[model samples]
Target chain A: MVPISYYLILSGILFACGVIGFLIKRNIITIFMSIELMLNGVNLSFVAFAAQWHHLSGQVFVFFVMVVAAAEASVGLAIIIAVFRTRETLNIDQVNLLKL
Target chain B: MLHLVLFLVFGAICVAGAVNLLAQNHPISSALSLVVVMASLAVEYLLLGAEFVAAVQVIVYAGAVMVLFVFVIMLLNAGAEERTQGSRVALVLGIPGVLAGGLLVAWVLVQRTNTPEVPLGALPGFPKTIGALLFHQFLLPFEVTSILVLIAIMGAVVLASRPEPKMKVPEKES
Candidate 1:
């Protein structure tokens, strides 16, 4: 049986990668995907703790997170479409209509 | 032994996929890389005995969310973003900052090794157990989430629908 620390460390690495991606990626969709990557990393740690503590609540939380992620994805994509329709680009820098 | 090997393999896959996701210029490619990452994480969930989570991770994340991403990319006719000159400030500070944060978390996790080892042969996350808990204990939150999904659907429809021409003249006149 592998130690829980291994899972935690892996989660940390994935999450850091997500953060870096989020920072560097210019495309809004890719940025959103990085957010999902971070969420997945968090989910991994949650399941690890659930196993470590011999409880199921952590997994339940994961379930909720997944649900919310799905909802967010749908709405976010729609907004992205609307933005593209108006601005004609998915580049975050170009979509600066709101910039004062 | 086998568990450790599986973990290493899947963990490597996940990290590699994440890096590829960052490196890819095209959103579709990044989306595919994210699918790889999600699939690997689903395997990790299975390793932790959360079969239902593993299934959901594959179905909802790798499957549905990624498909939605691809669809949006296609609909938008998105091209690879033209790389601008690198931002010196982000390069100078951001990489080290992220790396330091990750290393610090890893170090802290390594220091706290007193967590009880997962019992061998124990099935802690059987679907039945999770289902029972979901319905019996977490029912309200679950129902609320369903409503949230419904609202999201409606919101998406409203946002993405073509704007009526009546609003165009007001904006143009301004």
Candidate 2:
């Protein structure tokens, strides 16, 4: 039997992978892709819980989240493009002017 | 029997695509892998009997968001170059990554063995039920979240589309 916890654990693993990727990757696009991965991880958990509860609320929430993720992707990509134009480099290490 | 096969296939796809997303140096390749991962997740949602959720997964994530990723790649003129990889610190970090993944697998196995058999009763008219719940119970929060996302999107676009700085001529040496 495939328990819901199996899905939840998968979600957790995906989330951890996303976090590690976000922290370790130096590329701007890669970081945002990691963010997307993290979002997907959460969506999986939400759907799993929705199925477990026998309610559609969790799935509906996933719908909302997906919508938000879409908007975030568009705007985030636009900003990344803008940054690339200004800096001519996509390397996060090189963009450390934001850091003190 | 069929369900098991489908699950194995999609699960393998998700895992392999995720590994590719992270392991590949090219951002476009990673983005494509992410699409593969999202498609499989949508399949999982469909298998769970959440047709609406599955549709949202495909339409919003795989279709729209991934297109945005592709757009960024095109606009930036990104090429496959050597990714900054391998230092003492990165390798040190890899240890914890492996441990975390192993621990997660163990926990899942334990929990799966222990979970009781619970039959999920279906809610009639899934979409309508969800609609009622959102409108009646979570109406305020729902609208608020939408507004917040809208504001963030607008702000990002406005900031991103700002005028470029003009090139300045250097002053002549005395």
Candidate 3:
């Protein structure tokens, strides 16, 4: 038997890594990937809680989250394509049009 | 014992893939690392007995989403972005902040709580069961998400399409 806390800890570590990547990475695509990573961590947490409490709704929610993630990935990638076309760069710092 | 071993191994792989995603300089490599992370996460889900979710994680996330990311990277011809001064400063500050926050949460969850240990296959997440749940109890949300996916498809097509070239006007006769 594994302590549920271990699962939670792993999830937290993954989420922390994602946050670090999101903050430190300059590329837009990489940052988007980090967002996905963060979402994954949350998904794991949801499942762990589901297991703890024996609730199917938590698992059901994971499905909804996945649906949203898929939709987000499609739209986000399209937006990324548009941004790349105009700015000709993927660096977040350089893409700052409203920085001033 | 076996359950614990499997859980620890996959969890380590998941963490390694995540770290590699951050360490990789190129977007393609990072995208691949994310795929690895997602795959390992599916295994983790399976361990928790969410078999359907595990399969979906592998298919939808590792398969479709990562492929989409790779395709976009190739299409954009995105090169490795140079590390800027702002990124350096962010790395210096953000790493510690994230670490502290994560540690605090883990400490609270682990040390403070008296939560019981979970055995393997805590709950069966069969496809039939989940499907029923989705179509019955969560019916409205499921239908709404389908519409959302439809809109996303249209939006992606519109946004990614190149603008049509302008028509050439005839030159005026002298």
Candidate 4:
């Protein structure tokens, strides 16, 4: 048997990496990927907690989260494509202006 | 014993993939690393006995979402990252801060809560059980999310599609 804290710790580590990636990455798409990483980390936590409690709701919540993530990814990538169309660059630093 | 070893191994894979995602310069590389991370996460979910969630994680995340990310990267031909002053500062400051925060959280959780130990395949989250939960108790949210997905699809189409060309008006003769 593995301690529940172990899973939670791993999840925390993943979330921290995501935060670090979001902060340090220059590319907009890479930052977006970091958001996905954060979501994955949270999903892991949810499932871990569910297993610890022996409740199905947590797993159900993960399902809802996955649905939302799928929708968000589709819309977010489209927005990214649109931004690239206007800015002609993927670097977040260059996209400072609201109107170009 | 074997469960702990498997868990640790996959946990290491998850961390490695996430770190690789951070280390890689190009968006495509990061996207691939994210895929690796997600696949391993699916495995972890399976070990937790959330079988349905694991399958969805594999199919939706690894299959659909990553594909979308990779397709966009290819379409845009996104290049490697360039060093910027802001990024440099973030790299210097963010890593230690994040590491500290993670460690603190882990320590707190380990110390404060005597969370129970979970064996492999502890709580089998079968599809049938999940399906019943979705259709019965969570029915409203499920429908709402379907509508949300529809709206997202429409929004993506509108945002990504090219603008329509203006039509020429005929001049009136006196």
Q: What's the distance in Å from true for residue B89, model 4?
A: 8.5
Ranking by TM-score: 4, 3, 1, 2
For residues A1-100, could you state the per-residue lDDT of candidate 4 as single tens digits? 9988888888888998899889988899999999999999999999999998888999999988888999999999998988998899988999989996
Question: Listing every candidate in turn, what is its Cα RMSD in Å to the true structure after a full C-alpha superposition?
Answer: 3.8, 4.7, 2.6, 1.9
How do the residues B6-121 of candidate 1 rate in per-residue lDDT, one tens digit apiece? 88899999999999999999999999999999999988888888899999899999889999999999888889977865466668898889888877886787689776655432
lDDT of each: 0.87, 0.76, 0.90, 0.90
Q: Per-residue lDDT tens digits of candidate 3, residues B23-122?
A: 9999999999999899999988898999999999999998899899999999888898797876666667777877788778977886756777888988
DockQ comparisons of all candidates to the true complex? 0.72, 0.44, 0.79, 0.80
Ranked candidates (DockQ, high to low): 4, 3, 1, 2
TM for every model, in the order presented, reads 0.91, 0.83, 0.92, 0.94
Q: Which ten residues in a row have the lowest lDDT in candidate 3 chain B?
A: B86-95
Q: Can you tell me which runs of candidate 2 are displaced by over 4 Å? A: B85-105, B108-112, B116-125, B164-174
Kept native contacts, fraction for each prediction: 0.79, 0.39, 0.87, 0.88
Question: What is the alpha-carbon interface RMSD for each candidate?
Answer: 1.7, 3.2, 1.3, 1.4
- Per-residue lDDT for A1-100 in model 3, tens only? 8877888888888888899889988899999999999999999999999999998888999999999999999999999998888888899988878532
Least lDDT summed over 10 consecutive residues: which range in candidate 2 chain A?
A91-100
Q: Give the clashing residue pairs of candidate 2, or none.
A: none
Error of 4 at B19 (Å): 0.2
Predicted candidate 4 versus true structure: per-residue lDDT over B68-102, tens digit per residue: 99999999888889988765666677778887887
Q: After superposing candidate 4, which stretches have Cα over 4 Å from the reference?
A: B87-100
